[model samples]
Target: MNYNTENLDDKRLVALYKKMLLPRLIEEKMLILLRQGKISKWFSGIGQEAIAVGVTMALNDDEYILPMHRNLGIFTTRNIPLNRLFSQWQGKASGFTKGRDRSFHFGSQEHKIVGMISHLGPQLGVADGIALASKLKHKNQVTAVFTGEGGTSEGDFHEALNVASVWQLPVLFCIENNGYGLSTPTKEQYNCEHLADRAVGYGMEAHIIDGNNIIEVYTKVQELAESIRNNPRPVLIEFKTFRMRGHEESSGTDYVPKALFETWETKDPIANFEQFLLTENILSADNIEEIKIKYTKNINDNLELSFNESKIESSEIKELNDVFNIIENEIITHSSEEKEFRFIDAISEGLKQCMERHDDLIIMGQDIAEYGGVFKITEGFLEQFGKERIRNTPICESAIIEVAMGLSIAGMKSVVEMQFADFISSGFNPVVNLLAKSYYRWGQQADVVIRMPCGGGVGAGPFHSQTNEAWFTKTPGLKVVYPAFPYDAKGLLASAVNDPNPVLFFEHKGLYRSIREDVPTDYYTLPLGKASVLKDGTEITVISYGMGLHWVLETLKQYPEISVDVIDLRTLQPLDTETMFNSVKKTGKAIILQEDSLFGSLSSEISALIMENCFEYLDAPVKRVGSLDTPIPFAKALEDQYLGESRFEAALKSLLAY
Candidate 1:
């Protein structure tokens, strides 16, 4: 269906034509820079400017947007300084990234633009989160997410759509069907003829539009945005357009068929829109010339300004050092009077206190709301708070984690539960890519907490009984905490919640219900990098945490001859090197123990820390005691043999002999 430009006013049609021209000019210049070796590589939205500008103009300025790498048109139209865009492409210090993030990872919170994530399709989930936050905050705003047709084939796209549909979130998912996914055509990527058709499975409003027709693109998006704002439901719009150039500047155009290029070139969105403007008499020849001249001058001025601007000083790094400095100038505001609470109760109370402090804080997972979580840690939360605060999500691990990351990015504190510790693998991508690297990449904090019931001892088979603390400890920018008792659990959880980073808080399934201890009633926080000395001795230093602390306590009682100093390294990311070194210095020997496998375990990290810091101080080589390389066995006898306790006994005997 063709859209007639005759219905629209001359000024609006001319403005649309100008917007389409801007991206083409910017992209044409960028291509020149690329060929001249001034820029490394880039993906240009040359022929697809109408789709970007139309969709962006359709939404309000207060609304949020998450765009993919090839979304320069949207960013440019949204007033992302053209010079910064050019600088980013040139890899200069004055670039949008400041040499830290990639060129396309641009965003401005002031402009209500959430940063773009590089991964395909995950932005849809982020859009959902932003929309949810808007709803909760009582803001009349929609979140529009842009991605390629190729992204629709990803599991994240389906998962995101399913979540948005279930929650009836206000999100506009725009798919730019640019024909090729880095040389592979859409027909080779998916079975569907139109990408918008796939949205029917999620029961969402779906439409396919001629992306080249600026009026049609704008009208459809405006209507959809209004529908979502009123009813707050997910909408999917597929824009059929084509890329005028190869996928990136570095890629050769040989892979694409000449016939396909010829066919698509005739249907170029910018060229078609320009022709429409002229035929409808919406833009005079003089007006077109004036607009080109104005844009050229503006682009040149921006380029000159950015080039001459002072580079982001490396000395400015210290200014950003305290960005996540949670402990800085913190007043110990806890009341002197304290009340008693159990470990499970403390976990629940800590969450409640945090939620009360931060209105943006949300807790969600399976059985989390009414059931109060699997272990009743979140019991009475739904009754005390509303369903919005304490949510019960479907048993979709990947969806839960991705949504948490999305919410966190949208300025919300999300605490997610992995019903079982072993189930965290399902949400590993969001944890690793979105959560762990977000701060480092885009200077945005992913302040999220993943509470998992970890460890073994109770008969929860191999599937349910695994201490996978090492899996996250190995990832940088992720803080892993294992609290032995209720007091520490409450304090550490409070600290993690207050921290401006992602934290993995592992609550041992064995200790959650079995172990009970007195916890402070008021809000109190523990230092993240500090360790606690459970017991002091001279001969050997036993470095352990979580369930291993119990074994260390028991072993010390049995072996009077082995004067062991037990140190609980609370936070794994910034391990207490000073404490570990001092303890090892006094003891002259070290033993690391944990319930996980020795290969690629937290024990290895502890051992490395010891060797790196106080190798000469060590009288004997640092020994590690952990589970066998094989998976945890089902039988009690086999499980006991496979875990760290047996190895701990053997290591202690070996250290005594040494």
Candidate 2:
């Protein structure tokens, strides 16, 4: 059990011991704060401090780090202020997120930390992405990502590891095998005896270490970190450690047996290291006492100072707005005479133009390069823009999105395509945790565009036919754009490509080849939050988007007497409320229509917005027309029944009658 620290100086050994002690003390302090009602509940990183500190110390300062929630030791050793961490626990203004995030959600770009994304194994893909970028940019920096053993089962982990191994990315995939994930142990989570063994399947070099032993953990990590930096190849390291506390501050320890607790307590990494230092004559008892007193005094003084600091003012609402700063006056100008173009062609041209204007923009997806994408919209792009700019990605949706997020964070504008909108669920974590919440959590901007071919009318069945715009619309800090026409498609897509935030660009599969109008060959940009009034009428206001707009237009042609004012909600998140309310107030009636299911769709939100703003002006109650609450059937007759053009007409007629 006696591990030699002969290679390390006395000062270095003491430093390693100090690093392990910080998280232990911080965890104890956090528990006390939680009990006293000063801080909110959170997971404690008590027994696993050795692994966190040792692995972090192995990496260079310029390298990137993506830590999970149970990475307090890593954050503490990296010199994150104790008071700011405390403020985060308290959900106070002085916290890293300024009260917008939970405790343990730490991120700091200044320290080369890419932030902790909480959705389990997805961080591995993100780490690979950062490493890929570092390689592409020729930066001598590796990306180290930490996760739990439970994360290994996710498809994202396998996909990312495979890609990293194939591409030889400079990444260190560290799994904190802390025996348990919430209530389930590793045996219950994975079938393999050792999690590190799984890495071999992906062609990655795997390592297994005693995570409780600081010396062993540090030595193994140092060797791997050097190999990764020298060869720039991805490696997976599984650190077998134990959780000294429950999963989180709110978790009950009843599930853990008393005997197991006593056993782990005796093998406490912090106490064991202290004893080892004393027995080896590296540190006397007096030195141990002096080190503890110094750290305690430092933590206590910083905590008191942070607590005494004045809280953020309520009137400073503008501070939150400062997080998103749009570079104004960069708008591109276009001629008033708009020429017609097909929706697919417009989308293709928009991306080509964006890539030409901004060198940082890169496009990738299934069949995007040689095949020019599934729809052939990207035809000739690979030739014109080179393979680097218009690259083809494997059929890995999760890895594709994770790469886009990482590239965006590294100052590249990435346009990632999900072959079909329905498959977006595979990459939901990157879109939600990293893309949508990047600016809000870590103060980092993600200028990434996710182009998905959505909507159903071609009988593609449930798998290929879907409108998941509602999913992204429901999440804040993201822009969702569904253009109805070719001009809007070109303009809106151009705008989205240039915007500083993450955008979900939904290109209706039905509209892509079916619709065409006069779109200008020259470059143009449209305002993202603005909606266009297609046909102005006074009888009733119809709010619709994407393929639903076509249905409404056709219905208007059939019923000339209805005299409807149609408003196209081009952008869903920053909804054109002014135009929407004005149209409703002028008509005194509104109808919201979409192709998505009626339950919790964007149509419901449109109805609520109308009712909230134009309730008094309404001549009748607002109505919504959408697909029935059922899956899109494979049969033509069933599909028609589920989603019909007549349904929109009926809703409009009902609104007009009222």
lDDT, candidates in the order shown: 0.80, 0.83
In angstroms, the error of model 2 at 447 is: 2.1
Predicted candidate 2, C-alpha RMSD: 2.7
167-238: candidate 2 lDDT, tens digit per residue: 788888889898888989777999888998988788888889888889898888888887777788988889
Say which candidate scores most in TM-score.
1
Residue 192 CA displacement from its true place in model 2, Å: 1.9
How close is every model to the real structure, measured as TM-score? 0.95, 0.92
Q: Write the per-residue lDDT of candidate 1 for residues 161-214, one digit (tens) a residue.
A: 888898888888889998889989888999977899888888988999998788
Overall local distance difference test of candidate 1? 0.80
Clashes of 2: 7
